[model samples]
Target chain A: MKSGALRASVQLSRSTFTLDVDIAVAAGETVAVVGPNGAGKSTLLSIVAGLLVPEAGRIEIAGVAVDDVAAGIHVPPERRAVGLVFQDHLLFPHLSALENVAFGLRSRGVPKPEARQRAAVWLERLGVAHRAGARPRSLSGGEAQRVALARSLAIEPDVLLLDEPLSALDVETRDRVRSELRTHLAGFAGPRVVVTHDPVEAMVLADRMVVLEGGRVSHDGTPAELTRHPRTHYVARFVGLNLYCGQASGSTLDVDGGGRIVAAPDEPVEGQAAATVRPQAVSLHLQRPEGTPRNVWPGRVVGVDATGERVRVEVESEPPVIAEITPAALADLRLASGDEVWVSIKATDVHLEPA
Target chain B: MTTPLPVRVLAAVGFAFVLLPFLGLLQRTPWSQLPSLVTRPDVRQALRLSILTSLAAMFLAIVLGVPLAWVLARTHIPGRSVARAIVTLPMVLPPVVGGAALLFALGRNGLVGQYLDDWFDIRLPFTTVAVVLAQTFVSMPFLVVTVEAALRSTDVRYEQAAATLGAGRWTTFRRVTLPSVAPSVLAGAVLCWARALGEFGATISFAGNLEGRTETVPLAIYIELQRDRDAAIAMSLVLVVISLVVLVALRDRWYRVQG
Candidate 1:
């Protein structure tokens, strides 16, 4: 066990679902746990925070065993030096922002004057010192989020856990608070775990990302790695790439569900491989085009969605493909839903990963 | 939208049914004698005793009922539902029956009372303490029910947040849970106090209505009605005013819960 590290391998079972995961984070590292609802994202945070006990697991924080099921050791939540920032902030409605931040210090036997002094410093660092006297009900969403962050940080715990910290804010406030959170998280020396369903938040806030799907880790990698070679369907969609798995031999690949795509990877392909093509790498044409591209197929356009300056066109073919094109290209092709279109992908643009 | 004519008419009749008794009391009140009647020494003594006993009952209810409310709201003890039913039984039981039950359990020669007398030389029946006990017996359910409902509705995530922030169970209860339901506790105490102020059947049965001891305003009113009707009407007017003040004070909280 490394000093100032968090290591947890936990398994819990319920009537409807089961969660099994192993995660570790070194000091000064932030890991984002991203998953769909009911994927045990919040459950993982709860277990780490000592709010929920795992039936079988060992959790070590800063080289101290907070929970070891086999050893019959389980430290209660109050005894575990863990800071948790909830999705809704959950600030004490009766307390001022300063008192909220001081709560942990006071509970730990810090004198009231010293607690208030330290709390004031944290509130100042979070840029909400002026709002210290205000109750949570009066603060704006972003202000409340900052206070919640400060309250958690004030305790100076061994590990920091944020469960959708910016999810309760409005879209306008969410962007600013997320950036501010990134700065604060970077400043903290402890291991940090942030749980979020938003891929962008995970990518922007965390040094590495863990994809939890159906209560198990499906993929774990850096943002660039995840974007380049997404392992799961959810991740592929999140990265806006069309992915396929199939048998690979030489430069030709036979995709599952009756599709064929030619791929040229940096390494030679073997028996089983996964291929990913960015939406931008795919192209749509009204007629079959003569080009150096190795992969081309005719398919009916199933959906057309306008996103900002570009449009995403989903073509219903064998191993369906999504192609992103500019509005000018869309107009040039005269694309619409249910229209027959030809899809093309260059062999070099199809990235492969070992299955 | 305007209410339907039939509904409005029926509501008016219901409202009148509730208001007619107050109007009758007012009509019988001798305005010239009301001041002197209320200032009489016996009336003053009963009034002061009523205030002291009712306030004591409210305080005792809070000290004991809040913890009971928390247990009912948060715990999963066996037979919790049955325990809750028993705790709230006083709300539905007749005040006379509750008084009799209290007497059987706590009267001088009664079950627990005999033990108290033999071991501690404590006699509870027909005392000022008995008056407070009877009032608490009949009114504490109001407090417990209100606070329990508030605790049930509070977002427990705040308590979880407190625990994660290093607050122990007692600290979480004191700093988070109790303050979150403060308004409900206050409203419950006010309701309990009002109920205790008007207590007659319970005090008469258990405490025996001793002047300056257990003879609260309600008991005094009952006694005055036979000998001095004017004094009874004056005391009834005082109670009516107090009830109105309580209603006004609780209007916002009541509507918030109802709405």
Candidate 2:
């Protein structure tokens, strides 16, 4: 019930899909909702922004009830003090940067002169004052993004929602804009929600990450926590770790599908648990060799994907694992699809968590 | 790609069919007497009345047609397709038929006109106002159809952006939606004005061609052709020039929208 807090429990059903989620963010906290396509990430933001009405739920922003289906108190989007930055920025094509920033203020009954002056201040703060007279179509992508952020922030809303803010930028501009966005987001004194599918962006901008899969929150944790113990296959793939669920007893764990992984003897695991192995820790050899490695499995290479400076080799072993190796190592192994290989993992590298 | 020879030959024929009338008008024009013919009091009166009434009709079309267009393009009202068809009926209906229909509804002894006469003492037929109304009846469809098409194709996301910025529906339409489609609106207005300026059958049937009252340039031309062919030719030339100007000004906009 804090003044700047945002809380929502929404349930909406469409013909094709249903979204039901409950989330709460304290004042001054930034939470990132990361999910794959069609997971209702945008729908969640829309509900909180008052652009969409939930079938049966309540949404409160800054301790004010914006939507309550049972209470029949559904505020329209224009009345809700929520600022939304769409993926493409959606800058008014006909207006100059200064006028675009002043739109919200002018709409709220601010006098033209004062609104323009305040908008000028925001433009200066965002480092786009020089382009204030330029139309949105004339401004560069980075400039437009800064103007969009300024426009949303100029409203001085109780809560801010950004939907895939950096997804529209090219690779080169995304990094620069992302860092600038983080600084701007930190300056806002309200609950902030960012929706994105990129794991790196979620890790960098958000204080906490909420993983949404199939319109449900599959995992919610800090970057490090989620990286260490991913609860679902999507999160496991997101962090590039090989995950397995099994029954763990003492130092050994029996995987559910079909594999046995030995854990470090120091950490005793009991009952049903999950284990994670970093792709970097899995070494592949052409033949089974004698080594200090506690876990070794013979499997056939099912796929090889060369990404950047590393190659990910998918092996159809007992548990089916993905191994990341350098191109030099791949060249030496000459790994390709359908090649036979032996995979080895050190016991210490196998981290286990209770499922 | 080159068009086939038969297609090219047939296209030339069609083009010539359209252009031949303008060439005939130019050939028959009394260039030496044009100055005296166009400056006659009756000719000037008709010209002034035509400009005034057509401008009035164009204004009325914008006021009424924009909202109609918005409803057609944005709303899911019941019988929307039927409503759209009814609104566009004047475009295909003969001008004389449309005028006759208007007479049955708004004439002094007619359905709504009888009530207006009883309660407000207002008569619409045979007045200068009737000319404008008849012209608007025929020309408004052009504006409505053009604007509705533009509205349908416009991006709705900008309006959503406006809402999130604390703009109410009216403000969003005025500031964002209207400006985004301003070009199309201008093109539609010009077309409406041109159509209104050339309206003839509707004005003659519904409003009656009373000189200096409802006798617009087109009606004046028909009346003058019986006695003063040169004056009629001069007035026709004026209308043709005005229409040509409108078409040239709107050419790029029309092509951009269609293409």
Candidate 3:
């Protein structure tokens, strides 16, 4: 991979919201900016792509000062070496798929034939060469998105920004296009940022995850680190983990309300800490039994919700526990609302993050 | 789910109110002598002049009105509503009033026209150019209003996408914005040409009905009405047929409303 970096601090004030964030991406890095709707995810990409002007701060792409408020320098979007694929794949409806991909080249003064040749190459590379002659309105959703991707990538941009590239596709098409996008991003040397509301997509396409909430960066780390120890409830919920914040000593975590959790292999976190345990790690039992598992609590079932093949049993224990059990296991245990049950979790299942 | 009987009767009355005049003109037309009537030297001259002036007026309106529409629709020019009202004033104003206003602006010894006549020796009133100018003055507002509405409704994100793809402002407008609003432009131009072809009051007021120079079909029809009503009816029937054919052909081919 070639060396290219994008570093920027963006600040904007709007009537509905204010966005202030500083982000950096080194060469060959793909960072997923994940957030719910209206969390400033698209705004961040827009600022980096020079589509929106910042109120303050600066942006440098590939060592070029694209925007510097104090220096009073701002490069127009057309001159900036940043490519963005909008959420809706805003391809030129009047142009063919190949022409849409060739637009950037033609605008930059490349010869017509050469630009078309290069656009064809990109279309083939993105697996949409057969549909190159079709206009955007005629192309399928997935095919249009692929053409949009090819169009952006054809510019050989120093920084690439994708705003929810797969959110428009159907479930079946999403998976295939996602993997294809991953392959393309892996080969591109530029610093790439993919903004998506789906944590699953972030995990699949990004090297690092940056979670935004209400226009603020709530968490930034590797996918594993974020999933293992989410700092906020949104992040924890996003990764489907049960998180608790309390005080921790050598091997035990004192639950804020009542019960104590013992850690099998505890790290050196002594004060305020958080522990995340996957719902799959907790098991339900008919009665108080279990010798191997250290943590056990008796609680009544608050709710039983089924998602996909697994049934989630929410137990109102001391700190409240969610246990994922198979439907067969659920039927065997006859777990329903207001049913008494015992939940057991191995201490090793709890991953702690020291605050 | 069905229209009331009274409403249907009112609609038919409205339709007949507009169609009756054309039917009356067709009935009065001298069918056997139509060829001779149209081939009269004065009628032939008026036909050629009317076609020339209307075409010229349509061309001028397109060249000037499209950009004005863009400014009105896309830019944040202060007092935009006031500007739009002024541009569309000719649409509603009496054609003779519009002609008088043009004379005040462009006639010899008039405000700007005095200097034009003194310095450039270009006397505008009662000339062929004045006929084109009068037609353009009355017809341009239609084009501007239609094109402006089209421009306002175009998706601006397409232009943003073009900019991000490295196309500058002018290139984006030429390649993306213009093409997007082309159907409206064509429709506006056709309407403008039709209005210009039928202009009578403004042309007579601003550009007097000269023999072969400034006399258009409408002016010729007005003149022939005083001498021979059959010739006037013949000319009116020709205009009605031409307008119907042009409008139907254009709407069917170019501007068919999408479902």
For candidate 2, write residues B105-164 as lDDT tens digits: 999889999999999999999999999999999999999998999999999989999999
Tens digits of lDDT, candidate 1, B119-162: 99999989999999999999999999999999999999999999
For model 1, the stretches where C-alpha displacement exceeds 4 angstroms are: A1-3, A264-270, A285-307, A314-316, A328-342, B253-259
Give the whole-model CA lDDT for all candidates, comma-separated. Answer: 0.91, 0.92, 0.89
lDDT of 1 by residue, A1-355 (tens): 1239999999988565688999999999999998778899999999999999999989999888999999999999999989999999999988999999999999999999999999999999999999999999899999999999999999998899999988898888888888889999988999999999887788889999999898899989998998888888889887778889899887677898889989888777877888989899998888898969899899999999985689999999987999999999988888889999889999999887678
DockQ of each: 0.86, 0.82, 0.66
lDDT of 2 by residue, A245-325 (tens): 999998888999898999895668899999999999999999996979999999999999995678999999898999999
Q: Provide the lowest-lDDT 10-residue window in model 1 chain B.
A: B250-259
Q: What's the residue-level lDDT of A335 in candidate 1?
A: 84
In angstroms, the error of model 2 at A172 is 0.8
iRMS (Å) per candidate: 0.5, 0.5, 0.8
The weakest ten consecutive residues by lDDT in model 3 chain A span: A260-269
Interface RMSD for candidate 1 relative to the native interface: 0.5
B1-259: candidate 3 lDDT, tens digit per residue: 9999999999999999998988888778789999999888888888899989999999999999999999999999899999999999999999999999889998997889999999999999999999999999999999999999999999898888888899999989988899888889999999999999999888999999898999999998888899999888878888888899999998776646422
Model 2: colliding residue pairs? none
* TM-score of candidate 2 relative to the true fold: 0.94
